[model samples]
Target: MSSPIQRVRTCRDRGSPMMTGRTPRMVAVLGVLACAGCVDRRFIIESNVPNAQVYIDDQPVGAAPSHSSFEYYGNYTVTLVQPGYETLTKRVHVRAPWYAYPPFDFAAEVLWPFHIKDTRRYYFELHEATKTRTDDLLNSAEALRLRGQTLPAPERPALPKVKPGAAPIQPVAPDAQPFPQPGSGGILPPPRQDNPLPDVVPRVGP
Candidate 1:
C-alpha cells in the first residue's frame, strides 16, 4: 500500500494538482474575487446651483455635488430643487460598458487582470424663477367679460296665441255714445215744496 507522501507524489505525477482539497477552496475564492469586479458602477451628479437638494426616484440622496451608486443599467429619474429657482428634472440612462456586455463580459469578469471600475459624471444648469403672469391673465379675462356686457341683447319675435274655442265677433262701432263729464252741468236737481202745499189748502176752503 502506498503511504500518504507517496500518494501525494503520485497525484503530482498524474498532473492532477487541483484534485487536492485545499487547492479547490483556493480556486473558489479567487473566482469569487474576480467576479466581484464586475459590480455596478458609481455615478456623480452635479448642478450649477450650489447646495440644491437632489432626489432619485423620489428618494432623497443628497444636495448637489452628490454621489450615488446603481445596480441597474437603465433609465433613472433625477430631480433637483432649490430655493428661488425653478425645480428641474432629468432622465439619466446608465448604459453598460462595452466590456461588461455580451461575450466580452466573460473576459471582464474572469480574464481581466485588474479590478475594473466604471465611473460616470453628469452636470446640469439650474434656471432662476420668473414672475408669474396670473394677474395679467385675470385682467384680460375681466376685460373680455365687460366687453360682452356692453353688447346689445338680441330681440326675439313675439309668438301668436290660439284659443281652443272662440267666435269671430262683429267689429266695434265708431260713433258709440260717450260718458258725460262731471263739470258739464248735464244733470238736473229734484223740485222743492215752497208753493205746492199752500195752493191745496185754499181749494179745500172754497
Candidate 2:
C-alpha cells in the first residue's frame, strides 16, 4: 500500500511546476551556440634574435616573438622578420571563427613590379596618371594594340685605322705642280727635236 502511494506521488510530480523548469532548456541553448560558429585565430611570430620588427603592406604589425590575430573571416599577411635571415612571410586564410591554427612565426609579403612614369603632362591627359611621355599615358592593353612604324636601324660609321708613326692624311689637289727645289745647280736646257735642228743650221748627213 505504501509503494502504491509513492508511485502516485511520482506521477503527480510530472505535472508539477518544479518538474519542468529552465535548467534543461538552458543546457540545450548553450550546446547549440558552442557547436555552430566560426573558428578562432591565433598568430605567433618569432625570430632567431629577439625584438625583430614586423609589417603588413608597409603598415607595422608588431615586434618579433609577437602575437597578432584576426577574428573576422578573411585573408591576412603574417610577417616575421630577423636581422640576418631573409624576410619570411605567411599568408593566413582565416575562415569563420578565429581559433583554427596553433601559434607560429610568420612574415609579410614581397616586392611587386614597378612602373616608370613621366610626371609632366603630355599634349593630352585623359586622367591624372603621370604618363607624361607618349608611351607614358598608354596602358599595357592599349600600348600593345598601337600600330606604328618600326624604328630605323642605327647607323654605325666605320672607325678609321691609324698607321704606326704616320702623319695625319690631308687632301691633295688634282692639278698640283711640284715647286723647284732650293740648292739644286741644274739649269736644264730645252731639248731640240730632230726636225728643229734645221732652224739653226742645215746639217750634212754623214
Candidate 3:
C-alpha cells in the first residue's frame, strides 16, 4: 500500500488541471462584479480679460479661466462679460470622440474597466467698449437738423382747379340774413297786419 502522505500529494497533482480550468472563470466573474467603466468630461473656459464672468446657455457659471463638467456633447452658448469690455457671445460645438459614439460607447462606458477622461478648452477675446463723445453727438444732431431743413416740405394738396368763367365764391358777412323775404322766392307767407277794434261805449250796457 502507498503511504498516506504520498497518496494525498498524488491526488492533489491529479486535480490541479481542474483547479486551473476553473481559475479563469472565477477571475472573469470577479472582474464583472468589481470592475466598471466611466467617462469624465469637462471644459475649460478662458478669456483675454482675466476675471471675466462666464455664462453657459445664458446661465452664469463663474469667472473665466475656469472649468466645469458636462455629460453630453453638442452646441454650447458661451458668453463672457466684464467691466469696460464688450460682452462676448459665441457658439461652441463639442464633437464626440470615436469611443463616445454608439456601440463604441457601450464598450467604453460599460465594459471597459478604466476611467476615460475627455477635456475641451475654449478661449475668447474681448474688445473695449467704445465711448461716445458729447461733441460728436452734438455734431451728429446738428447735421441731422440741417438735413431735415433741406428736405422740401410736403406740398399741400393742390386746391381743386376752378374752371374758367366759373362764378367766384363770395364770402358771406357774419350778420347777413340767411333766409329770403316773402315774395322774394321764399316759401314763408307774408306777415299779417293787426286791425285795432273801435272804442267800446260803457253806457250801452242795459
TM value for model 3? 0.51
Clashes of 1: 0
Residue 86, candidate 2: how far off, in angstroms? 7.9
For residues 1-206, write the lDDT of model 1, one tens digit per residue: 88999999987877765567679798888887687655457878899998999898888889989988877688989999998999999998888778877799877767675677777888988999986799889989999999999999999998656566866555687654555689997755445546566544445553
lDDT of 1: 0.81
Model 3 accuracy (lDDT, Cα): 0.87
Q: Per-residue CA lDDT of candidate 3, range 14-121, in tens?
A: 999999999999988757744667789998999999999999898888998979888999999999999999988999999999998889988887778778889999
Give Cα distance to truth, residue 105, candidate 3, Å.
0.5
The TM-scores of all predictions, comma-separated, are 0.52, 0.28, 0.51
Query: What's the ranking of the predictions by TM-score, best on top?
Result: 1, 3, 2
All candidates' lDDT scores? 0.81, 0.50, 0.87
Clashing pairs in 3: none
Task: Identify the candidate with maximal lDDT.
Answer: 3
Model 1: residue 168 alpha-carbon error in angstroms: 56
Provide backbone clash counts, one per model. Answer: 0, 19, 0
lDDT, candidate 2, 80-186, per-residue tens = 56555556665655454222233311110111122212121111111222433756546654655553334456799997887999997887966544555677864
Superposed model 3: Cα runs more than 4 Å off? 1-36, 133-135, 138-206
